[model samples]
Target: MMGVVYTTFMDMVAERFSEDVLDEVLDDPGLSTGGAFTSVGYYGHTDMIKLVVRLSQITKLPVDTLIEAFGEHLFGVLVGKYPTLAEGRSSSMELLEVVDTAIHVEVLKLYPNAELPEFRCERLEPSVLHMEYRSKRPFSRLALGLIQGCAKHYGETLEISHESFDSEEQYETHFTIKRIQ
Candidate 1:
């Protein structure tokens, strides 16, 4: 997709996407549009054919093409933040300190401050990274909103793909990821 456009839009929202909301939207069958299209404004699923037409015309990009591009873009952001979520595998072990289980990605484009938890991150291994973050107790709406944005931008299954940590120190850990299929 367009990095400059996407980042600029995300910056305005100040939040990342989440998986739950995305999944709900995707499962609707109305929002499919074969791929995420902006033609119909994603208003609803009342009419699938109209939605498809709008999606195609809105972005000027094919529905299937948009879908593939969207997935690639989201996954790219996921891998980029892998260090922030995987704290233990890294030598820095900084991002691992997070108490929230939200993915640190750019998918959150709908809400302000909807990005991942505020934390420090460092790369320890070529294949592994680490992060450090903190959160009170219980998940916050903002956090949930961020994940929803991710779902809207990417697929929905990503949220469920997350693995939470019981320890107060390790807020959450993502073991099996990229399950957006």
Candidate 2:
């Protein structure tokens, strides 16, 4: 069994990810070559795939090393935030903010399109976050890119950017997102 911090981190990561990438890949069949997937659409490029390819070409290190590094860094965030993961409920609200900050601080460098200027947790119950983004188009491709990119860095179980919206067309209005684990 995974340690509490490790498990919580992974679960949180998965919650932020899994959805948008799969949806992007499945929705766009012509996304990558050979019908083989290495692109996770997180950075709007097969950069994740290319990063692997480059690593493979440069050295003999196993690809799992790359993934584990991400997992390790993610775990570090959780451990730093809540050193006693095993003894607590692992407050979902706090976990959400931690993961969100991790994405902005780290993942944004990898996907430098729209910066997450402000991602505050306006309302935590039922997992509602009041977000205010300054993007080229509020409901445009860049917006989706921003959402999906951040989701990938969560411990490994986040689908924060995937679920269907009760509504999402309005530019200057509120939206609902499925609360992430």
Candidate 3:
């Protein structure tokens, strides 16, 4: 995983919880980096899992809920860092349609080794989008949250539903997003 993800997660922890809580979350002896992450340094994906699990335990929130919330926070962080990703995009579907093709392409230019989830999107109707997400990591809920964040960013309301398939090799999810208002 990219270091920016880990760093952004840590930043979200500090901002949503507290500096002291962030310290507590980072005190895990099992963390390979000792909770020290840099935006330009790579780390194991398991490290992020451990941190999120720890945060869930401390906050009494479900792991999925925490991960989804983190994804929403991450979207904001990414947009703040790279404004062009959302620039000239008129709607959530418009932005999402190019995530894999344009946005991830830019990301790969910066970090060639970054492993990003694949998104296959199609417009089912003028107000509806069908998207399939495939990833080695089980983060469909995170993707959902990111989608929600994108809709919110565009001041749009969406009704989203998903079905997931999990296997030893990968996780796949099909999402249907409809503009409700």
- Tens-digit lDDT track of model 1 for 96-132: 2232334334334423333234544444443233433
lDDT (Cα) of model 2? 0.39
Query: What local lDDT score does residue 166 receive in model 3, on the 0 to 100 scale?
Result: 80
- Residue-by-residue lDDT tens digits, candidate 2, 68-174: 44444444454455454423324433444543456455545655643344344455455555443332223222233333333443333333332322235333323
Global lDDT of model 1: 0.36
Which 10 consecutive positions of candidate 2 have the poorest summed lDDT? Answer: 1-10
Over 4 Å off, model 1: 1-5, 8-55, 58-61, 87-100, 104-112, 115-181
lDDT of 3: 0.90
Report lDDT (Cα) of residue 16, candidate 3.
91
lDDT of 3 by residue, 7-120 (tens): 888889998999988999999999999878898899988898899999988989999899988888888888998998789999898999999999999989978899899999
- Candidate closer to the true structure by TM-score (higher is better), 2 or 3: 3
lDDT at 149, model 3: 83
Best by TM-score: 3
